[model samples]
Target: MATKMVGFVWAFLIIIGIIYALLSGNISAINDSILTNANKALELFLNILPIIVLWTGILKIAEGSGLLDKFSSLLKPGLSKLFPSVPKDNKALGYISSNIVANMLGLGSAATPAGLKAMQELQTINHKKDEASAAMITFLVLNTAGVTIIPTTILALRIAYNSSSPSIIIIPAILATASSSIAGLTLDYYIRKRNK
Candidate 1:
């Protein structure tokens, strides 16, 4: 439903823009913009494609080499505390750890499969199928406020755009994401405690 609404909004805005451009006798400008932006978008996508592919390959290698499992093991204790309802041996925890690790490295696209798998695994244990479980809500909060230590996509974009200091965003992104994660977890904790 939200996706449909967003699609409708984009369509409405595009229609409005076309009508305004026609009335203002700036249809030529609109045409030029469409072509220019399309080219630029394609250029940007091509530039970022290699970086995404490289990171995704590395992620796969980590998984195959058991590095991801080792990382997940390190995260399990803290994850168990956060999601007490989930059984310690549940596969959801493993997927959640992989998703979090991928996100931390700024590979959101790479993390998506693990995130989806985690949600599915979480759902299997949900007592109330119609309503989201508290663990699910907490996971949502954590994913939304994901603490990215490295903003790989943004760095790639900066590099593509010829930024002289692409890595300069590293510290600020870490600080912002860490703060948001802390705030979100704190709020979630209090809300759950109050509900109990």
Candidate 2:
């Protein structure tokens, strides 16, 4: 369904672009827009890389210092309620903690591996071959709606575009993420309850 929607959107955009090109009697503007967007995207990527590397390194150091482990331990009781099938000492707990920590710091690239590891571990505990387990679904919801403290990617783009006070977006980012997280968790709980 999502793929179909994407296809429809792209097709509509192409058709609209063609109509605009014909009515405006200029295909050059389309080419110019494409080139400009591509250049802006490249600039944004370059600007973000340094921040990504720096944050990932910091997270690595924190991981080595056992800070992430401590954070995991602190959250373990609550997490256990969400993932009852997983043992307290399970590697998935570690991965989930690291992923959440990285995300909180707005280091998504750094978090990807840990998130994947957590998902894989969750899958291993799932007995059904074709369907995802309740824990897996809940984890997915938590991740999708996870709160971001810094919103590093957006801040990088804003800085690249010469925005003043890029850090000001942090409050809004927190609010948006908090709302989504609450909604996603609520829906997940409702669905799981219904399933039972």
Candidate 3:
């Protein structure tokens, strides 16, 4: 549904742009913009690809070295409290921990596989397959309001765009994400309590 909405929005914007360009007798500008922006998009993708690959490799190394397991264990106590429905020894918790850690470092592309695995594991324990379980909803909220510490992707984009001080956004990103995480968790807690 969200994908459809995004597609509709892009289509609407493109139609509006073309109509405005025609009305303004600047249709050629639209052609130039399409070509230039496509090149810029490709350049941006190339610039970010290395960073994503490096981080993904690092995450894989951490997992292979048992570092990720150690980190997941450390997070388990709190996670257990957050997701009481999930068994303490469940693989879902481990995947959830890994996903959160990856998001915290701003490695969203690397986090996707873990997140998907977490959801799959959660589904196995879900009694009502048609509806999202409480744990699933909570996880969704947490993931959406992820507390990012590094903001690596944004920093990479800033560097690619020639920003004078790419790291300047670090503090603000941390504070904002932390606030969002806190608010989301608080709201989820209340909703859960009310449901019970």
Can you tell me which runs of candidate 1 are displaced by over 4 Å? 1-6, 19-26
lDDT of 3: 0.87
Q: Write candidate 2's Cα lDDT for 33-93 as tens digits.
A: 8779888878778998877777778778877998867876787678877777788778887
Best candidate per TM-score, number?
1
In terms of lDDT, the poorest run of 10 residues in model 3 is 147-156
What is the alpha-carbon lDDT for the whole of candidate 1? 0.88
lDDT of each: 0.88, 0.82, 0.87
User: Could you tell me every candidate's TM-score relative to the true structure?
Assistant: 0.88, 0.81, 0.87
The 10-residue segment of model 2 with minimum total lDDT is 68-77
Q: Residues 1-196, candidate 3, lDDT per residue (tens digit)?
A: 9899999999999999999999999999999999899888888898888777777787788878988678767887899899999998999998999899878776787678999999999999999999999999999988889887776567778989899998998888789888988899999999999999
Clashes of each: 0, 0, 0
Model 2: CA > 4 A from native: 1-26
Off by over 4 Å in 3: 1-5, 24-26
